[model samples]
Target: MKKEKLLMTPGPTMVPPAVLMAGGEPMIHHRTPEYSQLFRELNKNLKTIFQTQNPVLTFPAAGTGGLEAAVVNFFSPGDRVLCTSIGVFGDRVATIAKAFGLNVEKLTVPLGEAVDPRIIEEKLKEQNYKGVFVTHNETSTGAYNDIEAIGKITKNKDILLIVDAVSSLGGLDLKTDEWGVDVVITASQKALMAPPGLTFLSVSNKGWEAAQNSTSPKFYWDVIKARKAMEKPSPQNPYTPAVSLLRSVNKALELIIEEGLQEVFHRHSQLAKATRAAVEALGLKLFAAPQARSNVITSIKMPEGIDGEKVKKQMAEKYGVITAGGQEDLKGKILRIGHMGYVHEGDIIQTIAALEKALIDVGYPIEKAVGIKAALEVFN
Candidate 1:
């Protein structure tokens, strides 16, 4: 017999059994009325999740693909944009912008700290940027930016506010329309409780105007074409769509609505609090700043003289619990535990117990059951 490993990574989070069963259902033809009805309903539900009245476009790509579509559809080659980078995903926005020939300026903060909106406001005043790129929740460092404040800064201006809500949407509260966000991008695999393969973006009216003027070369990622197709008698994608993933997302959205969006957000907050408390109880330090901590993922600093990779490996092999390590510059120095989507108190408690044992097994001094006891206290 083999042990079932608990997936605690930032992405590809555990999928609910209902969603899995939905994805396993018989496939429907994309051009048929059946599929079109399902697609339309999915988009409608997604608008509720995004808190927007705009059209939410779906693509057969990962979260990165949604990010690229946002860049190419809203800005031309020489447009000036400000990318406020706090971690790896935030920096990726800048990298993608530069790759597309945009004159990118970065307002970067330390790895685990969120970027200050005041600095961004001052920078915006100094330059006439065409757009601003920001990550709503940076999973790399477990930092959450103040998108509402940033949106207020760019809302009345001629600048477009594009957000990477890849890991945050469905897990956190994002008021897309009220916050004046022009474009919001997210994927299915995170808090949406679906498999990876599809990315969704909602474009405001201002975002549509920017798209009409954008001269960037695009075919598969063309939003206008997608929107046109979606508006037709039988809604469909510009290219082949992930029908199975769509079915799964439809089910996932149903579950979210049943639970109520506010309740879902509250659940994530409680889970994060419990996870953080458990980590601290095990004598570990959280990586993200207190005020900027995210409810999606929790990144912990690797204790002195303890190998982060060893801890992760031990958690998987010995305890059947999987965790993620840091990326890029912070690699081997931090560990990330995801508590989004289908996660609950039991999952968090199990992961913390596994982590406590893993730390002790990897030569770190930690008392047994301390982490689980702390987590239980939070749950109680």
Candidate 2:
């Protein structure tokens, strides 16, 4: 079999060689003072990236685990929670809320659009809810909800604001404290550019209070236990962490700080712009509305009579490129081009070229070389 080419999918995306090395730098004991110091440093660096005065808790799980921690720790059975269902992850939030026996009310928009805060305000006025969940970047649809505005509406209200920022946390600007976000959850992959396994959650004082009231059954994901353990002078966890992954995470955060957050976001913006230009030049429609498109990923509508999955396969098998197909109800209706984390302008150009070939292979006609030309306008 041919060697698998580079990963240009949303995640686990391309890992920088340095971070990969860090992950492979010999496993260490999770209990020693050496590991404790490493954990402490990792926690401190995470706080800087999250821009939160509150503690940013780390776990040996994926982004979904972080979400579960937020739900199980802060909400009990019969707790009223409002979830926004705009895409796959949003629906996952609602599902988790239901599994925890919470009373869930989901406010939904179409796959490509964002939920309006005014609508949320109207719901808040009509009824009482203990918490609200919002996904900052809907990776499935490549739509980014306005969490800052949403938080503004929820401030001083009786609801806790939970955010799923897995794909957007480090790529985009998220000021957890200033935005009034009660709990912000993220993963080691995506913009963090680390291997999957580690999860991060920043909880506010209000979120902790909710946890005190919560009667949910949780041991592995118990925020209170993790918080207490983290506060120890040694800074170890109740459970063993993915030590190597955390090492990579520390280095990844270092890279983010070295480049500066603003410049990092700017790079993502330029790459997304170039990808959009290339796709539009090929006469493909974008799934996300202009205002709601995520800088991390761009979901494009599949042209009529084309198999989106076939395009993904062709790109991988034939062109040495990898791109993501749509999810859930959008399985064959769209294709997602991710430009987050380690994705640079050259990666965007190569993916566009592979996509053009795949499109033509699947019988969509387009002038040769036009897409790349349009994309170059952004790069040059």
Candidate 3:
């Protein structure tokens, strides 16, 4: 029988063997001492990883849940919030704010680019917005925004800074408190190296203050409640947590700690560079601008006559290499190559080779050996 294929998508990335094993461990009652220890350690380590002195809350939900929590628990009806929409995830921020009844002023830039800080500052000057929402890394177009610059721009405005760092968290350097971000949201599957189903958030004093006055109907995503429970001597949660997922997260965090954050960031940067080199060597164009490209996922424009979906399908079916096509309007226009989490040099080479073959099989004019050779040059 053929071995199972490797995943190279943006989220739900390949999990390390230790994390997979931890997830298979027998479940324990969430209220028991064993679970209490696990919860305590998870909470503590998440703070360290987030680089925040404040408490970081964990929920047994997806990254969307964390985004919802940030929206619902921080703002109320009729509140004005400024959001930047340069790609898919950035648009999600605007959408979530609208769904929560906030007056969303969306500042949009072209796809494959980042919103300008000058524009954000200009917008802040025009209106007294309650909060500013930005996605640190826009996964769809592989564009990475400079949250620190945005954070500084909002500092004097007295507006709250909420950042979506779901795909960028461990892959890039995101200093939460130091950057003056009031709320930093992340998920398990991206750069965190854990499986999906768990979302994490770090809330500063300013964010907690906003929560105290917010009138949104939120019981599950309440930061105050989660923080209160976490501070208790015996760990407890307001609901039945995802016990196995949390265990996996704990093990994942251990690997992160042992490898060190700087090393993790460097690894992702190297992989991203190698992937970009491969794309250029194949005579392909990258979707995102060089300055705004993300280290986790690389989006490449499809050759004029090649179908992006066909490339994804053929790569998976013939080479056992799983990749993703573009989202929404970008469908059949570009291909997304994810290099975050457990992806390594070998995985990168295999993906480049498979992509070369897929392009050739689909009648595109790619030289069969170009991509792999370029990738090997970077890896060596």
TM-score, candidate number 2: 0.98
Pairs that collide in candidate 2 are none
Per-residue lDDT of candidate 1, residues 1-380 (tens digit): 99678999998989999999999998888888899999999988999999999999999999999999999999999999999898899889999999999999988999889888999889988999999999999999999999999889999999999999999999999999999999999999999989999999999999999999999999989999999998887788888889999999999999999999999999999999999999998889999999999999999999888889888899989999888998988888999999889999999989998898888898898899988888888889
Q: Poorest 10 consecutive residues of model 1 by lDDT?
A: 231-240
- Alpha carbon deviation, residue 126, candidate 3 (Å): 1.0
lDDT of 3 by residue, 186-220 (tens): 99998888999999999988889899999988989
Cα displacement (angstroms), candidate 1, residue 199, comes to 0.5
lDDT of 2 by residue, 145-210 (tens): 998899999989878999999989788889899999999999999999999988899999999999
Off-target runs (Cα >4 Å) in candidate 2 are 1-4
Candidate number achieving the greatest lDDT relative to the actual structure? 1
- Candidate 2 shows a clash count of 0
> In model 3, which regions exceed 4 Å deviation?
none
Candidates ranked by lDDT, best first? Answer: 1, 2, 3
From the highest TM-score down, the ranking of the candidates is 1, 3, 2
Q: What is the lDDT of residue 211 in candidate 1?
A: 97
Model 3 lowest lDDT segment of ten: 150-159
